[model samples]
Target: MRGVSLIILVIFFCGASSATAQFYQTTTAHVSFYSSAPVEDIEAVSTEGISVINADNGTISFKVKMRSFQFEKGLMQEHFNENYVESEIYPHATFKGEFLEKIDLQITGSQENTIKGTFTVHGVSKEREIPVILNVLDGGQRINLSANFQVACEAHKIKIPKILWKNIAEIIEVNVNADFQFISK
Candidate 1:
């Protein structure tokens, strides 16, 4: 019957639409970096980071303004923006990559996965694989992400004066945390 065929077609389209998961996004993701040495302790935090995640395919991207990083000491911040990172010249840092493990919106749990992507900072780009934890929070409606990684100063072409070598470390520890909510587009 034509009625029966029409009913089946409507149901099929409804089911197909529900199969794909919604995209998640956040604007105030937090990112921090810490560098410690015997001569000085350096650290900064930036709460202006932005991130987007594709729940269907596990694709992720992030961007943060270099000048948004806040340091404890004013002199340190000035030196960092001028002599070290040159924030005036390179104003932003970004990452684009995908998770190795697939994310299922129907499930609610945490998965440890590696994200391989290109990281661009201070006008230099490098390929990196970072370990991260993805959690399906709030009954699969929200996603929580956290990652800790090390970035080498030389990799980003950040120059440190020889006199200040004792004050700054060669490698910096970066921390990222974000809670994303599903956004229907």
Candidate 2:
């Protein structure tokens, strides 16, 4: 009887470890952009972004459309879509990357890591390294990621008119906040 109980305990532990490796989650990630100038500051917000997060492996992927961004003023939004971003042509921006290898979330309480990935915008793709702060909660079952990065308008082929050059900055700062829930598949 003792030998049979020991064998059952070992089998249970092995199955538990394998089950922990396949956890996944999905969330509605929100992103916002802010432009600052000496005269005024403009802000735009977008919530129609989707994120697929793997809690067990700490991998994140997100997608957002250019048209989903909303600005404070309608005229500025129109100009942004028509002349600058050309949203009608290039519809979406995507990021695909994983955290630096071997930074396991199981051991770390809270981690500040860099996510290096390729970001595609306005039909242009560029390699960007974003500084991310992640909070591991509920024994690594929930993850909250926050980051801020600057995007150059010219790099993505966004052209600012001479009349509005001083109003809009050359680079825009983008902020992201995402919270994910665990999903078992």
Candidate 3:
């Protein structure tokens, strides 16, 4: 009888451990972009991006509005919307992807993982794989993810005016850091 009871207890604990692996989602996530050039590069920043992450299923969807972008100077901001990004037509960029592998919440602290998803920008969609570091906290109830990746302007059909070609780099680096709270459904 004692051995049987111990086996049942172990099974119960294992089942509970599996059930505790839950994920969260957030729309107020933050994202930013940066470009580098010799002396004329244009650098901008935006924090009004939205993101939804499901840690349990390893799915992520996010979007950012071009109009929310802010540049170092007013003139640059205007030019970015009018000439480069065409904010009036292609107003937003988005991404939908899932983590390549399941993140074990039991490990706690921070762990690096690969995220595989399709990124849409300037009306173009392309598959991309990025490395992300996830910080699991609050007994796996809260999550913070951070990653940096680069995208070529031409891949998204973003054309640079011949006159300002020297003012922007062909490739732009994007940085993402998002905090999410578990959503009970």
Q: Best candidate, lDDT-wise?
A: 1
The C-alpha lDDT values of all candidates are 0.81, 0.71, 0.74
Model 1 spans > 4 angstroms off: 1-21
Q: Which residue pairs collide, candidate 2?
A: none
Residue-level error in angstroms, candidate 2, position 146: 0.3
TM-score of each: 0.87, 0.80, 0.83
| Higher-scoring candidate on lDDT, 1 or 2 | 1
Worst 10 residues of 1 by lDDT: 8-17
Model 3 lDDT per residue over 88-108, tens place: 988888777888888877777
* Deviating ranges (above 4 Å) for candidate 2: 1-23, 55-58, 101-103, 107-109
Q: Write the per-residue lDDT of candidate 1 for residues 7-116, one digit (tens) a residue.
A: 33233322332456466777778999999998988999998777777766667777777888999998999988988889899988888788888886667888788988
Q: TM-score order of candidates, best first?
A: 1, 3, 2
Which digits, one per residue and each the tens of the lDDT, describe model 2 over residues 1-185?
32343233223322343455544333356899999977678888887666655444545566777778898899878877888778899877777666674445575466888877778888899988888887777876677778999999899888877777678998999999887565553
lDDT of 1 at 28: 76
- The CA lDDT at 172 in model 1 is 96
Error of 1 at 59 (Å): 1.2
